[model samples]
Target: MPHIAVIGGGPAGLRAAEILAEAGHGVTVFDQKPSFGRKFLMAGRGGLNLTHSEPAPDFLKKYGAAETLMARAFERFSPKDLVEWCHGMGLKTFVGTSGRVYPETMKASPLLRAWLKRLDGLGVRFCPRHRWQGWEGDALVFQTSTGEAVRFTPDATLIALGGASWPHLGSDGQWANIFGKADIALSPFRPANCGFLVSWSEIFRTKHAGEPLKPVTLSFAGNEKRGEVMITEKGVEGSLIYAFGAALRDAIEAKGKADITLDLRPDLSQEALLKRLSAPRGSQSFSNFLRKASGLSPLALSLLREGQKDLPLDPEVLAARIKAMPLALTGTAPLARAISTAGGVRLDAVDDHLMLKARPGVFVAGEMLDWEAPTGGYLLQGCFSTAAIAAEGIKAFLAPA
Candidate 1:
């Protein structure tokens, strides 16, 4: 039997190992972390969003520029296939109101435990704290936790070391430089699904930091996302901002700053808001009156105040401002703080099988590839789908023709 070595214990590497081990190959998964799935567990702290329930066509669109490349992988293991795979592991899943799929327990622990157990039964081995350090004359080299070096020469190897996001969880994107030495094409990593920095007033930052603006609409570059965003000490972040992260990041990169519009009262029309603001201001303070009239939260009001020193008392002006308040994003959160990363091994560097054309039998998958998707379960789906595709490529490579 051919021996296969899988580097990085992320979802993509694990999935690839499972497929190879089940196909009768001797497989060993190596990771620098003390345990596997540290990042996966962290991601599921709130709730494990496994995949989206959106149709294949619409779901594919979430991948943005990588949609075409990812479509090929999704053709084999799609959202439906992912759900079924979970079911096969005895883990039942349900779709949330927003179409995100999660296990019954809404935690990743149980599912990961079951998966590890299954791989154990299939004779797969895991070597933890073994960090991959570039190759030594076609032999894979790793540095042990105790500062010892180890080497292995497997029949095949798959690299799924995730992106630059959540570096503390193990994936720090150091592989880019390693592969670059091998003459492999790589795109520099950038923050994705990340927050942007806004020069908030000290008063607003001190008061509204960490406060959430719910039921708000954020529009950028012709794209709009209706969700909630949290005001950070530096700027704003959360679901709504993440949806436009790539565009916002690019805009800031091109123009030095991005001008975004926030609809504080998306449900209320300008006319309705104008009528409400036209109401007489009695003994009630302006804050109290605006809150009752427009249903704006304290955080929303603070955000409004951030835009201008003094809000317009005129109903028309106030209504128009309320309808579309401008916010300027100066910069994106650091790549380390981003939810995920964009840019990686360019698609052209890898063949259709995801194997690096310059280095045959070395396949790449997951976030390490030059593809990115917004949050909302698309990231996990992309990881799993690409892992399956790469695993198939490995299997075909090892099989006798």
Candidate 2:
């Protein structure tokens, strides 16, 4: 039996350990945290979007440039395989209204508790409070919480140290430097599904901060997405904003600012709004007329004022403004505020098996790979798929029995 060492207790590391130990290999999962799945727990706070219910090709496209790289890994353990794996582990999942798959209990605590129990039963050993600090000779070196440095050489090693985001969760992305020292190309860490700074007026911030803008559409450049967004005192966030974050982030990095437009009423077209404007105003106030006619929320109207100095009094002008509200994006929120990261170890550094070309027995998976995907279950899907494929690769690499 091969001795397999997994360098993170997150989803990918734990999943890989499960596969390796289940195959009768001795497995050890190391983490700096006291327990496993800290990020997974944080993710579950928002109902735990396990995987999307979309079709394969369209869903794979969510990974953007990493689609091809992720596709090969996912081919061995697609979303369907993830569902079956969870079910096989005795956690039945149900699809939510938005096609997000979640455990039957809805909370991640139950499934995680059960999954941990299953892993323990499978003979997978978890060494918590042990932090990885690169390699010493041919052995893995780690500093224990008790201030003791330990080293051990394993038959195979899997690195799933996660990305630069949520560093507090124990994924500090320090592994990238270690890989770089080994002559492996690394991608600079950046925010992925993150928030953008809009520089809202104090009046709008005081009134509408933390308020939800639901059933609206956000449009930037030629791209448009429809979803709910949360307006913060400092910026705008939520799924819709994160969906366009990569573009906005790139624009701000390329230039100085990005001009983003939002449609408070995406359901209503410009022609239809023009039709509404054709209606007689009579003596009705503009705000009241807008509320009753367009059904625009107060927050939506406040967002309109983020750039509007004076409310458009003309019916046609008001209609046009209502259809397309513009806001100049100052910048992106800090990477620490992001939900996930966009960059990590370069894919070219790893072969088709995701093993580092520089280090034969070493492998990388999860967000540590240079790829970015949107929310709505894509993130967890990636973790499971990469870890599964990495496990298979490890099996093949050690397959001389």
Best candidate per TM-score, number?
1
Taking the tens digit of each residue's C-alpha lDDT, what string does model 2 give over 101-121?
887866788878888998899
Backbone clashes for every candidate come to 0, 0
lDDT of each: 0.91, 0.86
Candidate 2 residue 52 Cα shift, in angstroms, is 1.0
Write the residue-wise lDDT of candidate 1 on 305-367 in tens digits. 875868888889888888899999999989999999999999999998899999999999999
Q: Give the 10-residue window scoring lowest on summed lDDT in candidate 2.
A: 301-310
The residue pairs found clashing in candidate 1 are none
- Best lDDT goes to which candidate? 1
lDDT measured at residue 269 in model 1 versus the true structure, 0 to 100: 91
Residue 347 of model 1: what lDDT?
93
